[model samples]
Target chain A: MSGAEDFLRARGLWRRKPRGEGWLLSDVRLTVRGGQRLAIVGPSGSGKTLLLRALARLDPLDRGEILWRGEAVVGNRVPDFRRHVIYLHQRPVLGEGTVEDSLQAPYRLNVHRASRFDRQRLVEWLRLLGRDAQLLTRRQRELSGGEAQIIALLRAIQLQPQVLLLDEPTAALDADATLAVERLIDVWMRQDDTARATVWVSHDQQQAARVSTKMLALQQGRLQGGGSC
Target chain B: MLNPTYIELDASRVALAALLILVNGAISLALRLGMARTLLVASARTVVQLVLVGMVLQWVFGDRPWFVVLGLLMLMTFIAGVTAVQRNQRRYPGIWTDTMISVWVSSWLITSFALLVVIRDMQPWYQPRYAIPLLGMVLGNTLNGISLGMNALTEALVTRRDEVESLLALGASRWEAAAAAVRHAVRTGMVPIVNAMMVVGVVSLPGMMTGQILAQAEPLQAVKYQIVIMFLVASATGLGTVGVILLGYRRLFNADHQFLYDQISE
Candidate 1:
């Protein structure tokens, strides 16, 4: 697992209990290589979200380090690291603007300054998700939950991140929208499967089986039943 | 120009003014508003505090040495800083020191500039009569601005945690992630001073100008001083608001470009 192919690896990851003694997420280890679809399934309050956030470096780790491409991800490299490894929140947070503005927002950051917003590319991606260019003109506040999730997906995908940490990205969508999201992600993965990967935190085991080739179950902040499906 | 004879108020006249609070007490009693005790305590506090301040100012103004003048100014700045922090509803580690730094730097910097550059005739420049009153006015206004700015910053950070983190996750630097909150806080801190400037003479006669007029100064001279005071206050408030808000932004985020929203507590 400690190879150049390993894109993201967590070793002995620990998150302290927000209050009181001991760990909320204890001594967890995992590896994600290119071309892999890893799914983390766990019950509610099991620190699944904590684990994903820790991997994204959005939250602090108590006593562990995360490596990106066999290099310790640390200060100064964090923004660039986050740029490449985007985290899609469960509930989308769109700024006050049209959908096109939300998509264009990332380019304004200094880390993404080199990347220009390509409207043609976004239109193509939206079409794959059964959305039209008209959706881009609508205000974000007018978006449905499912539409917002789709916008969130396109927002990350447009950046061309190597790893997508999906934290229940479709938990709020209907069956059709969920399938559309899955299809869009499937297309994203197939586009550059060798260099791109995704780690999904999902509640639906059957959906997990359909989307992922490897599964890891978490219970009480401990990893269990790790194996290929 | 002939010096105008200023009418002096005796202690009995001040007592007569104090008796007007009975009207407020009567209203409270009639409405059963449970505020009579509060009104009484506040009035008492105002009298005691002002009388004590008057004595202190008299001593300081009476040919005090430079060190004593400097010491009193420092004490005033420190108290103003503490008062600003106490008015805020949120608490974070090192907030006191941050507030102190903002209040001290902004008020002292503008006050010194006024004494040395603006006024230009302060014999020895640290004369207690000029320095003490100028610094007091600046500190008073800066205190309000710092308090408002700190409150707005902390509240926005807490309520907009998700929005901030989303920007962080999207690869925004700490400044980029917290820019909107900083802007909002700085603007909130500045609004009161800006509004006061908008209506300084037309809507109300400011206390300093009124005091100067009562003390037999020419009305035009008093107006000139009031204009300068307003400008000094506006600058001090702007600098202090920006300083405190930026300090708060540094506290809530880190060098790692992380939004440490957990550090803030209600």
Candidate 2:
């Protein structure tokens, strides 16, 4: 229950209809510590993505409180929380520009104004992901889905967020690209901070097992508890 | 300065002017343009509306009451606001309020500033002759701009919700996230006014100048008044468009800065 050591914690999280339908996500409770890769897996329409979005503050929760590092994430602090707790969509959307422009986009925000887009660090991460300097020059629209996904993965990792809420991030990628993403995340986890965490939503049980140390099973919008798979 | 003799149109002259519409209708019918009924109805509607408006203007002009002038402006603003907000294909929550505030503020400010500060000729600031017509012109143009801007913004926000959410997740402020839509809306709104300004003296004779010249006013005097109106309309349209977009984009997100899907109509 100590908040200081917890990376991201959700208490009694639920999303439901105001009038008719049952809960989309119900009474889900989970705590993630630093450096843990937690996989949220469920059948389609089970609200797996909903839980992650709720955690990332991307979706409004009908009932629950999400705490980051033990403090309630609310108000002006929500942006600060978002800066650390980033959400990566399944189909990445890049601004109208080159890949480098997309990579450098985040720095335009006041929250990230103190940080600059380090070209050396971006190149390093791209190299780790089996990409190279030439990839940065390619136009965003010209990129293949897998290449775009890689760029998205790199964009989130480049920000050095504390927790990454990834919703089927590798859904469009090939086996090679998927492996590259997994390897890049592994390297990111082993970086100097050693306090970063990620909650990855995946349909592929095998890939989930390979990528995440702990697994959360969701069925009919309710958590089936840890390791139920 | 040459002495100007004003020629007034009699009832027979007015009826003769109405014959122009029959000629237009004849052309439409002969061409099988399908616009025959629409043109006739529109022509009739214009005659009725103008005659009614002329009577009202004569009353207000004869009296020169400030309240009457201001009341008419307020009425115009209310109609303009409703028209602007309803322009969206699918209306969203709070859109009416957003549009109303934007249209009212921009239209009122620009109209008043142009009439009182810029021109500074009316005996009483709210002189019905000057205030009613000038304010009416500005509000009419501003209505079009705000409507176009709001429609563009709402459509963009609804269609590109994912992109906006992605930007928000990148720690961008709501303004930053909706920057593309805002730019698009403002530019779209301003385009008509810009185009009108570009062709004011070359391609076509604008309504105000044409009206003044027809009323036997000096060409230079009419030109000066037309220039003032054009400037005011452009300023009001730009302001109104930007105002609506600015007020509108914030409403697309909630307190936590998440995109409000419910606010966007399907």
Most DockQ-accurate candidate? 1
Shift of residue B3 alpha carbon in model 1, Å: 12
Give the runs in model 1 whose Cα sits over 4 Å from its true position.
A1-4, A225-229, B1-5, B27-35
TM-scores, all candidates, are: 0.94, 0.91
Regions of candidate 2 where Cα sits further than 4 Å from its true position:
A1-4, A18-21, A192-194, A226-229, B1-4
lDDT of 1 by residue, A1-229 (tens): 2343888889888888878987878888888899899999988988888888888888877788889988888888899999889888999898888999999998999999999999999998888776789999999999999899999889998888999999998898899889988998999999998889899999889988888988899888878854222
Judged by lDDT, which candidate is best? 1
Q: How well is candidate 2 docked (DockQ)?
A: 0.66
Cα lDDT tens digits, model 1, B125-213, are 89888888899999999999999999999988888888888888888888888999899999999999999999989999999999999
CA lDDT for candidate 2: 0.84
